[model samples]
Target: MPAARSGSTRSRPIRRWCRSISRTTRSSRIVSTRPARCARPRIPISTRSSPTTRAGGCSCARTPIIARAARPPAITAASAPRRTRTRRRRPRMADQNLIENDEPLLVAKSLSKSFGRINACRDVSFSLHPGEVLAIVGESGSGKSTLLQLLSGQLAPSAGHVSYRMRDGVARDLASLGEAERRFLFRTDWGFVHQDPAQGLRMAVSAGANVGERLMAVGWNHYGRIRDTASDWLTRVEIDTARIDDAPRTYSGGMRQRLQIARNLVTEPRLVFMDEPTGGLDVSVQARLLDLLRSLVAELNLAVVIVTHDLAVARLLSHRVMVMKGGRVIETGLTDQVLDDPREPYTQLLVSSILPP
Candidate 1:
């Protein structure tokens, strides 16, 4: 009976061993068939100190391996598509040939104007060459705008003569020209950009018509061509062509200013007069407008005479700057030189006033 008990004990252990092997084989088959279902549970790194943790504890502690498995594939030069290079085109400006000349485009001598006893402008004389930009800068009532008016022939100088070289190569006194001839010159050879868009743009007319009117004045009669030219000018100034038929009154301030610019520039005038072109706009709008104006001025090579109280504007756009105070030019020189090293006390004061405290 003792020997029987020993054999039974041995059989019990062998039966248990067989059962354990069978269970392990079944688990292996299940894991092979369904890996997701049998995937090892993720133990957080915080569970590492727990007594229940077996072997190495938290799998999350192996961050390098986990990160490697989760990482996206690298991009290599061989996988990238080849890019073709093309030459960049330049901005096209109208009337390039007409303005390109050896002689100065416009000459002013002792230009002066007055309103009753007030001297609105006094002895403001400067010559503008082709592709040159001159900025008249000062405080309000300082005769900068008046000087611009006298130069553009919008106001007759009380004394002094403004002379412009004609397209036919004849330099004539602006005051001596016949009224009709002067009107023709104003329409074809000169462009005026006012501080107020309302003053420059026709509020009642469609934006397209405002631009096309200048073309019509120059004898562009074809309906299709005039519309096309107007569209082109609007696009050049960054206005959407969809707004071409809308009136200036329906547009925003910046849009109206851009439209006014398009109207004035459509005829490709040799000379342009601007009075505070970026005035009354928000800072962002002013920056964009100034950038556009700079690009257009460079592309067109148009001689410009601009009046502004903003010295920064003068520095950015002008080749030469004329600083005025009390209706007289106090200092005139290259833009950077005059602004950086002022020879006159008034100019020094003007520059210092705009500097940050």
Candidate 2:
């Protein structure tokens, strides 16, 4: 009976091993089928208001994965689209119509000047009429002052011609005139107000002498009449008649400027060339001087060509404005038109930069 029981235990062990092997085989089949199960995609169930498909009208089942990834995120009011601004058009100036009827008092035709390879003034041509004030404005080294010098005969142009009408109504080329005739014209028909009072005035001499010297140059030899005329001019420019005997060195900056103006205008010149007449003065003093200058210019019906960097001075005193850049006339027109609605980009920048008074 013991041998039979041992044999039955061995058989039982073999049956148990076969059952464990069957279980292992089933577990391996299940693990291997997981990948195939995952490979088959589930059919997407459609709803009335699906977040992804509702707006785009696309089915999630057919939608490309790349297309989904490439879609931009939603935008709100805070993320409104931006747009670029277009530039406004500039206005045309009516300069030709304004100066058509009047014969130009001074005509510069194709004026040009060159220093070595540098063109200091290039083909700058403009007309100045009688009783009209033209302001040439630009930054330092822009050739505005050089153009003034050329027009005034202080510097000869490398090319071009300047013609000025004589008292006898003949337009004479200034460059062709003799030195004596030019000197005579400068003393009688023209006046120049230098930027520095020392240059314009006889600094060592008395103010009366400074003014009377101009009269003497034009053949006013009577000492008493010259002194009387000088005294009258001193009063006219708002300088104290008593200070007429004082040297310009003893005077203030504004006074010296005033004295210089008196000296230039005392002869009643038909044309005047000013190089920053109101420069180097306090704002209040400049305003007063500008007023005085405007009054005198109008009263005398003087034609003027003024060179200045100050746009405010140009706006205040000039009938026409010429904007220079890189030795070229970039823009020019009536003063109000140029200052109020500048056409050129550079001129617009200049007009915009002016501080309001």
Candidate 3:
């Protein structure tokens, strides 16, 4: 009975060891059951493990496996869509006619300026179109200068009104505009080139300053940009960029005139008024200036009202001519037609006075 009891004790220990091993195996299987989303194929659970992490289980088997999508191919310039450029066509004669018929830029009806009892300009009525040059040709005492002053709003008319088309396409009387508005127009929309360069430009300031002053008035406060633009305009007016620091007082008459032009044109004014622009210059200088003016006017498509006594100047620069005798325009017509065949006796006499070239 003692031997049988000892055998039973040894058999009991062996049964307990087998039961512990079965429990460990079942726990490992439960932990290793992975979700179906894992890309890794079904892997067997490992029995070996780090002592610090776990007793007998694989770390990777306990953690969930994550799947990621493959990257797409990169796009190249060669595979990109192409862009096309549309070319601009030049306007035909019909297009020009249509544009002329659209709207007038400036219109004056029976405009007259009286200095007390003396009437400087009498009942002058005319219409100026965009991209058109109109020359008022007469003797020194004729009403052309006064008429120009009236059209530009420099002098108030006593009898009639002058109307100008604003940038917003509305025609407004100059007298109706406030002082600030009129000054604004002079700064941004209109330019006046005085007969004397000293009158047009600020002679005390540097050439760059003179040119940049207009820009400053229009709200351009950047120093570098204003200087660059002034330099470009100086070059355009045939003035040396090196002379940008020089004052207009030190410049020659022609140079000063060119600088004045640059100052006026820097703002790209819609309309420019000129009073005997080439009156004081030599023949060669006058020719050069006229050529430059013609090119610029055509390029910018500007409207100009130039008052000059020289019929040759009118012939060269104007598309249309208005012949003024005393304080009245005796005849008005196309430049060539008026100069070649004058309807009025005074116009005929004035045309005959020009020396043959």
Best by TM-score: 3
For candidate 3, write residues 53-72 as lDDT tens digits: 23332222232222111222
Local accuracy by lDDT, each model: 0.79, 0.79, 0.81
Q: In model 1, where do residues sit more than 4 Å from their true spots?
A: 1-101, 355-357
Q: lDDT for model 1, on a 0 to 1 scale?
A: 0.79
- Highest lDDT among the candidates is held by which one? 3
RMSD of each: 20.5, 26.8, 14.0
| True-structure Cα RMSD, model 3 | 14.0
The local distance difference test score of model 2 is: 0.79
Instruction: Give the higher-lDDT candidate: 1 or 3.
Output: 3
lDDT of 1 by residue, 137-256 (tens): 989999887788788778898999999998887889988888898888878999999999999888999999999998898899999999999999999999999988998999999989
**Segments of candidate 2 deviating more than 4 angstroms:** 1-101
Model 2 per-residue lDDT tens digits across residues 1-357: 011122221111111111111011122231111111111113333333223323322233222333333334435456668777998755343454344326777999999999999999999998888889999998889998899899989889999999998877688999999999988888888999888888988899999999999999988999999999999999998999999889999999999999999988988898999999888889999999999999999888889999998998998899999999999999999999998889999998888877887
